[model samples]
Target: MGRLNTLDDWLNYQENLHFQDINLGLERVKKVYQRLFPKGVSFKVISVAGTNGKGSTVAFIGSIYQQSNFKVAQFSSPHILKYNERFVINSVQATDEQICHAFEKIESFRGETSLTYFEFSTLAALIIFELEKVDIAVLEVGLGGRLDSVNMVDNDVSVITNIDIDHVDYLGNTRELIGLEKAGIMRKNTPCICADTNPPASISQYAHQIKAQLEFVREKYASDIGLIGKHQQQNAATAMLAVQKLNKILPVNTIQIKAGIKYAQLDARFQIKTINNKTVILDVAHNAAAVKVLSAELAKQQCSTIAIFSALKDKNISLMINEISMIINQWLLVPLDVNRAINMKALSNEFNLNHNIHVCNDMQNAINRALNDKQYQRVVIFGSFHVVADALKILIPFMKNNEEEIL
Candidate 1:
């Protein structure tokens, strides 16, 4: 409306323009892509798809490429703080003016077609990457890879970080079914790296059928990473494998790879901070698999910890809670400010039998409750990105020291 000027205005317009929030088909986006760039992107493409570690892998790759003196552009999803976080160029986020300009261009290109919110963002990021003439572009799939908007751009190297039972409604219920959906990103004769220790047979089967060069992380990278948890080594190794596949063209040395993994930083991935004299760990572990990883890391803390948790309506809240029930001494549940967030009543029902549960008024109240309790040595904020974002808005202002997350 009225030539939307602000980034917020364009975001609002995109949200209402589409009938469904997640329209997972590439045709609509591909049409718009053709109109925007008929010749296609010139930069090398690395598309990463999976349930959990897609963002981390993208970060590691971008960091490694950046360390090698190559101009890198990374496109990711579901920004924690702002929409600009979705489009990053050379470690810097796209500005509001740039985003507004990209949206206006998209609005002009799509004459009669409809694009979903995520599709619009994907096109915008690609347009920016092309305009800036980035050397390489790393894209994280927003959902299932087969029909996801990001798949419109053919990747030079495709990566499936790890597959698990996630997005069951859209992808499928079983890992085999889900694996096929993610395998859609792999192209014939192209290098495809799957970082899952034990991947589904469907993944290798699909690769065999398509003749995609499928490689698994049989050996983990024996190096220390800046991020905490042993699982990060797998993600870093996956990124390394992708980098090695493109070594002839990209040419990143061992020193650069090690430096990149050690310097890479992504927020809300078992991120540690000291706020108001209390230790808080923020993780976006919405699914059961990710929650299991978080639980393992929490176990190593070996201190009394309480969790402030809430998840989306579609998530298996019971399984996620069970993963860390033994590690977390108390639970502070809070509702998120999103349409998909589970309500207080339903969330309370998940922890009904637990004796130490606190249904806080909001995220801030939950943090306060956890900090005031002297019994807990640590406060963990986990569930969805929405929950962690809400905590950051309140906790960032009071953060006194940023703790190094080392295992």
Candidate 2:
């Protein structure tokens, strides 16, 4: 085990540390974490879990608390552009040196024990957050909450944003089963908020069984959050309500709440832009449920949409297509560069000539096809995070950096 001085070196080393891609248990990671950090620091921990809105809920919580003069450490997954984006402190992404130092420390402690990619990265985030002594840490669950590496931390406040059918192989196919998995984050007597109106019975049942104080986000805010769509309103209300419940731990005011709502925004979740004199909406909506939200959002604009889409094979593509079919005038589908990339022939067979769908081998060619024969006012790039991420390669280079909008 040689020294991993650079961030890239550490990343590459961790990528192959485990034989498999996803090792869904926490026993090995927990042993290594305990060995590394024997004495956990004092900081309020907020853990959020759900199928679709986990990231937004996390962004909302981080934004609101930071506005109230608290230094926040937020750990999220699946970095769109860079690995550094996964761990953020005080809204500033971790520098390569800082991440490398954390990774090196973890590696030193985890000599014999092998950790998965997500588990290693999560430990690094925890180490950096504790080393930096942030006031609060918000953790977004990487997968099923129970065995997910992040469940090792006892959350002061547990948030279950919404339960949907996702990760069926790992978390079960039914919503009730998935809800039980998400409810694993709840702690005894801790405040647990379920922002979903029709939450699964397993969530409430498990909360009751554990004697955790559970509450639905009863208050809905009518005011606009800096982001788009009505779905954001629910997430904002959940964040504000959660903060209010945490007054005993970290008190906040209405002024801070308003300011937080004014500034809270996350990239690739309904992010809109103008590229080549055309309105381009970039969304990481791979699931059918999220596609429904994307469709409803598209309804806000009367103009037809030309979409550049690609998704993993496991997703319910037929349902997703049906959900967004009304808004999309044409579909420019491309193959993703992932191990689980869907077979092109199987995907193409889902639609016929009347669907106005065109196939491309890669993202660049798909973009060229979309631009050459522009049939609509708006171009939507959705279906998966890979779609938006690949599109960013073309967008960020040619288009003037819109830090204010994109960031």
Candidate 3:
């Protein structure tokens, strides 16, 4: 295999790699990984799996560990702004050239074995982490934990953020079934942290079955986060307890944990930014559980709220709409340009919100119309990552222009 010089070439090669199906099977990918990188079992890895808050939890763990001066490697999925954001070292995104180089190595090593796009990327990340001699690596599971490619490695700490009904088709319909799938990341005698306040019985049962030290959020450690939303408190608490347990073995200091938890800035989770003297909040609340949290946060704010929403077809759009209906004065439904995107017409028909809702096919137009409206004091951009990504592109430029004019 030839080396990849440009980002586009690497991405193109990845696109042409084996197809991806969201399921809980790892035999083929694991065999390829074992043949290519047999030494991966020696690395220190932390696997995080949950329906929501996995990214934020990974960020918090990485930030705290990095603050303590440990060489840390972090891998996450479904990047918002850049592909490089998925892999980070010491709190900085890996350069495009670095990522391409890693991919090139993986491509050559695999030989006759075909790897899926995600499996190839995960292997590349592991290779980079090993080469860097990272003291610790945090991996966010792309789907259910048991058979997910990331679970191929033995993790020192397995973190489950919260269970919800996002991927019902793959996992299961109820929370217990989903919890069982996620609990697969836990290894024998390893410390597993459950961030969910009310975790499913299956998760606890599996932890006991494996003899893993299970730590529940409210039961293990309590936290008070400066960030808004009740759900964030649970995330923070889970992170704090995980770090506390990690501190017993690793050299993570309490001061670093406090500092990291206080200053962690995950881009799209209740993110508030002031643009042109107006407040804009961006949250990636595409599921029913997340929308319920966002609704609570909206109730606490003393401003007229206008929600810019979009979601994928697989999601429970009707339930999400029903949750946010009373809280938002106007609904700006924008269509995402993706195969799984839910069209505005389908959403409108399902919810019967014609009076307060306005359909805009273009995301930029929806954001501009919402931002320009003087009636609403606060504008919230929530839904899928696609919607939030489009809004960020527009909002960043608009805010920058306004700042430049003032200067």
Model number with the top lDDT: 1
Q: Model 3, stretches more than 4 Å misplaced? A: 1-4, 21-23, 219-226, 403-407
**lDDT for each residue of candidate 1 in 43-137, tens digit (9 for 90 to 100):** 99999999889989999999999888889999998999888999999899999888888888998999999998899999999988988989999
Q: Looking at candidate 1, what is the lDDT of residue 374?
A: 88
Q: In candidate 3, residue 34 scores what lDDT?
A: 82
Instruction: Provide the TM-score for each candidate, comma-separated.
Output: 0.97, 0.96, 0.93
* Count of steric clashes across candidates, in order: 0, 0, 0
Q: Give lDDT per model, in order.
A: 0.90, 0.86, 0.81
Better of 1 and 3 by TM-score: 1
lDDT of 2: 0.86
Could you give candidate 2's per-residue lDDT for residues 263-345 as a string of tens digits?
Answer: 88799888977766678888999899999999998998788678898788888888889898988889988998888778788
| Model 3 lDDT tens row, 1-407 | 36667987777777666665343578877876786677765556789999988978887887778778778888998788788888888878888877887877776677776677778778878877877888889899998889898998888889999999887878889999999999999999988988887789999999889898888777433454545566766777677777677665577777888777766667788888777577888888889888888888888867788889889988888888778777888888888887788777787776673548888868888888888899998898998888898888877877767643210
In candidate 2, clashing pairs total 0
Q: Please say which candidate is ahead in lDDT: 1 or 2.
A: 1
- Candidate 2 vs 3: which has more lDDT: 2
